[model samples]
Target: MTASLKRFAATLWQADGRRFPAPLSLLLVGPLVIGLCVAFILPVGRLLAVSVWNPDFTLAEFVHITESPLYLRILGRTFLLGGVVTVLTLVLAYPVAFLMARLSGWRLAVATACVLVPLWTSVLVRSYAWIIILQRNGLLNSILTGLGLTDAPLPLLYNELSVTIAMTHVLLPYMILPIWAALRTIPRDLPLAAQSLGANAVRVFFLVVLPLSLPGVASGVLMVFILSLGFYVTPALVGGPETLMVATLIGQQTTELLNWPFAGALAALLLGITLLLVTVFNRFLGLDKKAAS
Candidate 1:
């Protein structure tokens, strides 16, 4: 069996040449390419087909999506929520990333652990944990009431605020990791040199550090925003009925309504929006150029 396998391998290599042919490379990746087509491309193609396939070709699903005020409102809210979560995560992650980048020894390890440990836990677990913490009689309310901060429990869970907070926590690490990677790449002496040339600390950061870190910022923002847009589990667990997002609506259409065509249309619309946002970000922020450099 081993000798036969060796002979087969030798035949394959020699049949191509000393240097692999383009077709050989394609053959080598053929399984992966086919797998992707089967797994992703075919499903997406089918989805697109179904969106227009209402017994005969039609645009009724898309027409309904556009004409319905509720879906339009939900779409707008999804984008708005994604934007808020991205901004929040960026703001919170930057300080942690900066410290992680600058620290040494055990301190660096500790900071790194703080950023990464939560990621090891399941998203469902994290969302459930937040529910426990933010419920009417939960830990947060207990502490606040105990501290004389409020007479009654504040409405913390089952709202936009709860969803935003949970998502920010869940997505914070993605923002931190990229920004930290960017910060680490920046030479330490650039800031020191700027300071030596009579630049103040704030000015050195603005001119030297912040400018260089924009790549990471852009990357982190893009990632967090996109992920947040598709978020379903976290929002469903923590969010109120009124806190509807595109994903939840899609889920409802797919499972509750059993409306496959409408679901496919919603999914396609979301995919289009995602692509549009990426194009806009790349065009205005130049994320691609910054990443290349």
Candidate 2:
């Protein structure tokens, strides 16, 4: 055994020896990387080309989007809706994430299961559930009426509020998962150290926990915002004219009006915005590190 080991080491040290990486590595990676580039990258390239490059390479599409007050209004509204959904998800997810991180064995698992259970269910089904809960004579409205808050039901569904609620609900798991993971990475000793120095729980959270958790919060916010920007099903289901988002507008233009070029332009712009935000997030918060675990 010792002689065999010495021979093997001597052979490896030979100047003409070849490297030993598996031949299957390239075969495994090449096709997958090429497939992604061909499927996703090429289509996005075409959409961006159609957005700005017409037959004569004129700036007509750009001008139309910028000049039209309606387009600007829709763009602003989409951003506003995305922002609100992102904020709502953050606010709702933080406590859930903290509890999941701070709890022990079975309690943590149960909490995580609850958050993920909704994610496994269909978004359309959840949206429909919200509709039933928020509509006139719906559960929420009936409760409010029974409580003497109002004689008539409130207009809850078919508006921005409904859309925001649904989108936030749909994207909440994205916020919670990242935040919980981030909180888990924090050593338990840090909070104890803060407390040992006479700091209260509130101060420890705001000073130590919150700062350490910002990376996760940033990642989750970006994820929710990007998802909300491209959301069509929820907005289409719940949003009225007052709550029309960019994705629904793009779909209407392409499917109903047959304005393929305009729809392509809108879609390309949305994709660009999503990529830009993600790049910015990676630069600021190191998503790669959190995602690795």
Candidate 3:
């Protein structure tokens, strides 16, 4: 095995007995590395610089954010919103993904379609659909009135609840796909084997199945939360001004106020929070390492 690997490595390096010090794999990955630096790192570096220096070094933007309680509150709200959406999606998606994983034939196709069709649908369309269902005198209120559940239309639209519902619907498929992929890869016999060993359905799930599915759960949680934090249109469309999120605040600062420095600060702070959370998540869960295995 070692000799075969050595022969393969030698062939990659030598044209005429002259070895290039850099490995071929490095050469292959060089473009990807350069692309990442150009696309992600440089832009983020510039954003950080803009937050601190307005032609000259200044800490005013950061100070303004720190001194005012509003920005901090908005930041907290954004994280809270993300967390809520993540939990809702996880609860809703787990069963759906499990169903998708367990089924076969046309049933599987139907289940898969139900999960994916919404994805191909536009975000704007989906948000607008929520607005129609949730607005005063809309479908939900109409139904409630017809059923005599309420004397008048309940206030459903343009609130945190409305925003949460819309966002959860939009983000559900993300959670479902990762978990479905994970559940799909589980050995079909593991649960059956557990049952034979005197484990009931619930025990088999809580022990063998749930533990194996953690990497997917971790991935889905991270993706949904992060995506929710950056959401703009759904919140703006379904929520009132009082339901201010960090994205909306950043948009207001950039366009309405024309406060680019402050906007950069907000963006930088959000980026920092996202990175910090991702690092902590990966460290605690070892998501990528476990997922790869």
Candidate 4:
């Protein structure tokens, strides 16, 4: 058996006369490529097919969704929510990220734990906790009454503000970690050099550090914005019926209304928009370069 295997190996190597690593490389990667196509690509393709073309390959679903004022309104609202959340996360995460980059040893670990501890907690639990705090007769109202701020409890839960706040909290880590990594890569000397050249700390950060770390910030914003677009639970639990996002609309169509076609179409539209935005980010920000580096 050994003699026969040796003869076969020699014949195979002689037949193609190629490097040894090339065949092994293809053998290693082929399964991964096939798995990705089967798992992600095929499902996304079917979603797109259902969205744009209904039974018998018609564009009726696309027309139905795009031409309706209600659908357009929901789409506009989804985008607005995502935009607001992205901006708020940036504002909130930047200071956290800056502090993380500047800290060291136990301080760095403690700060990182502070950022990640909330993420480790369940979103449902957090949402419900917010509900308990924000309810009419909840902790917030009690505190307000104690401070003599108001005569009675105020309505805080089940509104757009609550949704925004909850989402910002949920998605905050996604924005912070990447920006912190980028900020950390920047040499400490660069800021010192800027200072020596008569630039103030704010000027140095805005001019020197921020631009260089922009790739990470942009990447984080892209992820948070896209994730915000599909958020369902927080808005559903906190904002109630008045603040319905497209994900909730899709869920209602699929489960309650028994309209799979419309749900599939909506899901497909969301996937397309997200992919397009990510592609644009990759193109504009040299995402590949930053990632490789």
- Which candidate has the highest lDDT of all? 1
RMSD of 3: 5.2
lDDT for model 1, please: 0.93
Which residue ranges in model 1 land beyond 4 Å of their true spot? Answer: 1-31
Clashing pairs in 1: none
Q: How accurate is candidate 3 locally (lDDT)?
A: 0.91
Better of 3 and 4 by lDDT: 3
Compute each candidate's TM-score over C-alphas. Answer: 0.90, 0.86, 0.88, 0.86
- Worst lDDT 10-window in candidate 1: 14-23
**Candidate 4 ranges with C-alpha deviation above 4 Å:** 1-35, 52-56, 289-293
| lDDT for each residue of candidate 4 in 129-240, tens digit (9 for 90 to 100) | 8998989988999999989999988888888888998999999999999999999999999999999999998999899999988877988998899999999889999999
Residue-level lDDT of model 1, residues 1-293, one tens digit each, is 99999976766665546676566678989999999999999998898788899776889999999999999999999999999999999999998888889999999999899889999999999999999999999999999999999999999999999999999999999999999999999999999999999999899989998999999999999999999999999999999678999999888888899998999999999999899989999999999899999
Query: Model 3: what TM-score?
Result: 0.88
RMSD of 2: 5.0
The top-ranked prediction according to TM-score is 1
Model 3 Cα lDDT, one tens digit per residue, 1-293 = 99999998877876765545467768988999999999999987886787888666878898899889988898988999899999999999999998899899999999889889999999999999999999998999999999999999999999999999999999999999999999988998999999999999999999999999888899899999999999998998899698899999988988899987888899998998899999999999999798889
Could you tell me the C-alpha RMSD of candidate 1 in Å?
3.5
The residue ranges of model 3 lying beyond 4 angstroms of the native Cα positions read 1-39
